[model samples]
Target: MCGILAVFGCSDNSQAKRARIVELSRRLRHRGPDWSGLHCHEDCYLAHQRLAIVDPASGDQPLYNQDKTVVVTVNGEIYNHKELRAQLKSHTFRTGSDCEVIAHLYEEHGENFVGMLDGMFSFVLLDTRDKSFIAARDAIGITPLYIGWGLDEMKALSDDCERFTYLLPGHIYSSKQGGLRRWYNPTWYSEQIPSTPYDPLVLRGAFEKAVIKRLMTDVPFGVLLSGGLDSSLVAAVASRHLADAEAACQWGSQLHTFCIGLKGSPDTKAAREVADYLGTRHHEFHFTIQEGIDALEEAPNKEEFHQETCQKIKALHLYDCLRANKSTSAWGVEARVPFLDKEFINIAMSIDPEWKMIRPDLGRIEKWILRNAFDDEKNPYLPKHILYRQKEQFSDGVGYSWIDGLKDHANKQVTDSMLMNASFVYPENTPTTKEAYYYRTIFEKFFPKNAARSTVPGGPSVACSTAKAVEWDASWSKNLDPSGRAALGVHAAAYEETGNTEAANLMNGSPQKRLEMLDENCNSCLIEDIVASASCGWHMFVALWEKLLTTKEGNWLHKQNEIVPYKFVFLFSKTFLKGNIKYL
Candidate 1:
C-alpha cells in the first residue's frame, strides 16, 4: 500500500508541473518499486511511491517536520509508531518513519490529528506556515486514496487527470475546511445490534493485538496462507509471536508462510498443514491454469457474513481492500491484514451480533467466535482439525480445477455472440460469465475509459457472495459459481484430503519433469557460483601476495621469493575444463 499522489491548487506550478508530477508519479510505479518521492510546495503536489517498509534507511517518503514546517506523503502502517515517538518528546523526528509521526502529529494535534493515527494509512499533509492542507483515510480504507479534479480527472492514475474520486474511508480532507470530514466514528458505526458479551478472553485479546500490531516490520514479512480460517489465524498468530518480533531481529525466528496453489491444491494441502503445524518456513507456489490465464494476460493486478461481516468490512475499501492493496503492491509486497485490523475491527465488531451467527443450535460453526478464540487447550493455537477448518473459497482454495480452467478457457474465448452482447458490450459492469467476459477483455485492454469502467466491482457473486448475499441463497441466485466449489460442500469435504505421499509425488510431478528439475537446480547454482568465484579469486591473490611482502618493492620481492623457490606453474588453461587443473 505505498503509492500516493497529491495535488492541490495547481495552475501548473512550473518546470512542466514538476515534469507532470514526475509523469503522474509514474503511474504509481507498480505501487512502489522501492522508491521515488516528490514534495514540491508552490502549488502543492506531494507524490511518493516508496515501498520500504519502516526505515528502509531513513524511511524515504515525503516526510519532514522539525523546522521544516510540516509536510507528509505516507501511504500506510504507523502501528502506534513507537507510541507516537513517545508522544513526540517535543518533536524533532526527521525519519525512522512510521510515517514520521505525520509531521509531528500535524504539528501537535491540529486538524485533530487524523484521529491520532494507529495503522493502515493514506496521508498527505503540508503546512509551510498557513498554506494549510490535509487528507486522510485509514480507519478501514486500509490504504488507497484517489481524489482528482484536475490533470483532467486522473485517467485511472493520470494521463492528464480529468477527474478522480475514492477518498472516503473514515475520511478527512481540509485545506482549511473546504470539504470532506468524517474522521472515523466508531461504536460500530451505529447500525445498532452489538451487545458486547462474548468474551473469549476479550476476543482472544483483540486478535492477539491484531496480530501483534501487524508485526511492526522493518521488512521481510509473510503469511497469506489460504489454509483459510482467516489465513490460518494469520499463520497461527504469526507463528506464535515470531520469536518476539523486531521482525525477528532481521527476518528470522522462522515464519514465512505464503501459498498460491493448484497442483494437489486445497490451498496446497491446507497450507502444508498450517506450515507443518506452525513451524513455518513454507513457500509453495505451483500455478498452472494456463499459469492462471497467463498471469491474467500478463499484468499487475471475497466474502460476507455477520451483518455480512459489517457489510463486508465496509466494502473492504472496495473488494478485499482493493485486492489486498493492489495485489501485494504488485509485488513489492506489504500486505498486513490481521483481519483488517483497526482495533481488531473495533473488537470484532463489538461482538453480540448473536455471537456472530451460524448457530447450528449451539455448536456455532462459522468463525465460531474465531474458532473459540484460538481454542488453545494448553499451547494449541490450531489443529482441532485445523481449528474446525471449513471455508476455502479462494477459488476453491486454488484447485477445483481452477474454476474449471477458467470456465474452459472462457468457453473457448467467449463466443455465443459474446454472451448475447454482454449488455451491449459492457454497458458498465456487464460481463455475466465466460469468465466474466474473459476478464472483461483483459480489463478493456488496460483500462479503456468511462472512468476506468466505473471502478470495476460488478454484480452477482456466489461463493464470494454479495449481490445482496446473492439474495441469501435460492440456489445462490441460480449458481453464479464464484468457486468455493459453487456453494461449499466444504469442497467435497476437503476434496480427498491428500497432503503427504511425498507431497503427492511432488505435487503430481512431471511438467517436463519439473523443467528437468529446474534445469538441474540451475546448473547446481551455476557450479556453486563458479566455485565461490574461484575461491574468491584465490583469496584475493593471497591478499595481493601479502601486500607485496609489506612493500619496499615487496622487500626485494620477498628476498627473491625465498631464494627462488617459486615455480608457481599454475598455468594450464584450455579454458581449464576436465577436472579443473589442480596442480598445486
Candidate 2:
C-alpha cells in the first residue's frame, strides 16, 4: 500500500505550490515510509509516498510510459500485472513495479482500461500531450482515494472536507469530461435477485483464489487473526497454500498469525486455539486498559441476509475498507483483505439470497455457507467448533473490558450534563452517549473545521447494520448498541447467553498459556507509543504531549518519543511540542 495525492487544473505552478504539496503529502509519510516521489506538469502535481512491497529495489513511483507522455502515480497492488505486462510486449518496459503497468495500460487503451485491470488500486494518470487527466479506483474501492475542486490547495485538500469527498468506487474522474462515470458493471450489481443454486465447492475455490492472489508481496506479511470466521477462513486458506506457493518459498512456509487483546480475552484465547490447530507461529500482544485509554487519540450485518449484504458491500469503501487501510498503513504495513476481492465478492453475491438468510429451522447460522465450505472432514481446514464459533466484533472480542474501559473513562470525563448538551455541541451528528461525546470532543479539538466534521457518517445503526437494515428486528430499533450481542436471536447463543455450549467446552479445556508480560520498568511498552504516535501523526502527538508528560505512563511515552525516528520529532517538536501548542 502507498499514499497518492494529485491536484490538477491549478493556475499556479510556483515553488510555493510544489512545496505545499510536498508538505501535505508528508502527513501520509506514516502510510508509506520507504520513499517519496513527485511529478509535476505545469500547474498539475501528482505526489506519492511509496511503501515498497513489489520489486522494492526498482519500483519507485511517478512511473512513465515509453515516450514519457503518459505519467501515473499509484497506491495499490495490481495482482494481474504480470499478465498485463505480457500483453504489452511492444512497449518498452521500465521498472519492475506492479503499478508500472498502469501508465502503459493508459497509453494503450485510453480510459476504458480500468475494467481490464484486476487489482485493488487508486491511481491518477496524466496525459501530458493533451493535458487530459483521469483518476480511477479499483472496482471494490479497496484502496482509498479522495477528490476535490479548485487550485486553492487548503480548500481543495483540507478545509472544505465537504467538497473534498471520497471518490466513488468503481468509478473514474476525467478532466476532459469534467465529471465521474461508473467503470464497474458486474452481473451482481443489477437489481435482480440472483437465483443460482448455492455451490460450496465453487465458493471455496473462488475465495482460495482470492487469498492466493493477495499473497503477491515481496515484504514479510502476516494475517490479522481476529479468531472470527472471516479472518480465520483467510488464515486457513493462506496456510494451506503457503507450503507450495512462491511467496512461502521465499518468506518461508511457517505462517505467522497475530492477535491483540487483553491477556485472557475471548479473541486472544480463540486465536491461540486456531493457531495451535493450524500450527502457525502465533504472536499475541496484551495491552492494559490504561494503555488503551492513553492511545484513545489514535484510534456487520447481513443481508436481509442478501439485500443488506449488497448495500453493505457497495458502501464498504466508506467504512470498513477505509478503517482497514488507515489502521494498517499507519505502521507502514499493507493489509490485503481477500473478502473484498472483486471476483470473490461477485461469486459470493451471485448466490441466491435465500441461502444467505439466517434459518434456524435449517440449522444454518450466519455465514454458514462459508463455514460449511471449509468444513472438510477428511482434510479438515479447522476444528469443527472453531469453524462454527459465534461472531464477535473487535470491540467485544478484544476483551469485553476494552469497550467497558473506554465507556467508564468517557463517563468520568464526560458528565451527564455534557451528554445532555451534546446536540448543541456537535449539532450535525449529535453524540447520543457519553463515550461518543468524549471522542467527538477530541476529534473536534484536532479537526476543528465544520467541513472536516461533516465527513463522518452518523445515524441510528444496530450491530453495525445500515440505518435501513435496522428494520430486520423490532428489538434492534430499541437499543442502538453497535455490538454483535445487540443482533440477538441470530447466534447459537443469544444476546442473553455469554457463550455457546459447544464453544464453551473448548475454552474450558485449557487455561490458556500466558505470554510473558512487560517488566516493571515498561521498556517494551514503548512500542505501543510508537504505534500510536505513528497512527495519529504529529498533530495528535502535539495535542497529547503535554497531557502525557504530566503522568507516570506519560513519562514512559516521553521516553518512547525520544527514540522514534528523528524525522517525526524534527517535524513537530520545535514548532508545536515545545510549549507553543496553545497556538494550535
Q: Each candidate's lDDT (Cα)?
A: 0.61, 0.66
Best by TM-score: 2
Q: How accurate is candidate 1 locally (lDDT)?
A: 0.61
Candidate 2 C-alpha RMSD relative to the actual structure: 10.2
Residue range 1-584, candidate 2, lDDT tens digits: 67788877777889987888888777667667788999898978888888887887889888999888898989888989999999999999889999899888888898889998888888888999998999898887767776774211122266423455667889998888989999998887764578888899999999899888888866656676767666778788889888877777666898877666665767778889988998987766655555555554340233345556666667666556655555455555567767777887788788887777667899987677888888899999888888988766666666555555555665667888988888877789897977667657655544566655655667776544677667656778777454545545644532122243322332222122222222344321122222212211122222233443355523432343232221111000111110110000
Query: 160-179, model 1: which lDDT tens digit per residue?
Result: 55546677789888878888
In model 1, where do residues sit more than 4 Å from their true spots?
1-4, 8-41, 45-68, 92-100, 105-156, 161-210, 215-230, 235-322, 326-335, 338-378, 384-393, 398-402, 412-437, 445-584
User: Cα RMSD to native, each candidate?
Assistant: 28.9, 10.2
Model 2 score (lDDT): 0.66
Clash pairs, model 2 backbone: 303-306
**Sequence-dependent TM-score of model 2:** 0.82
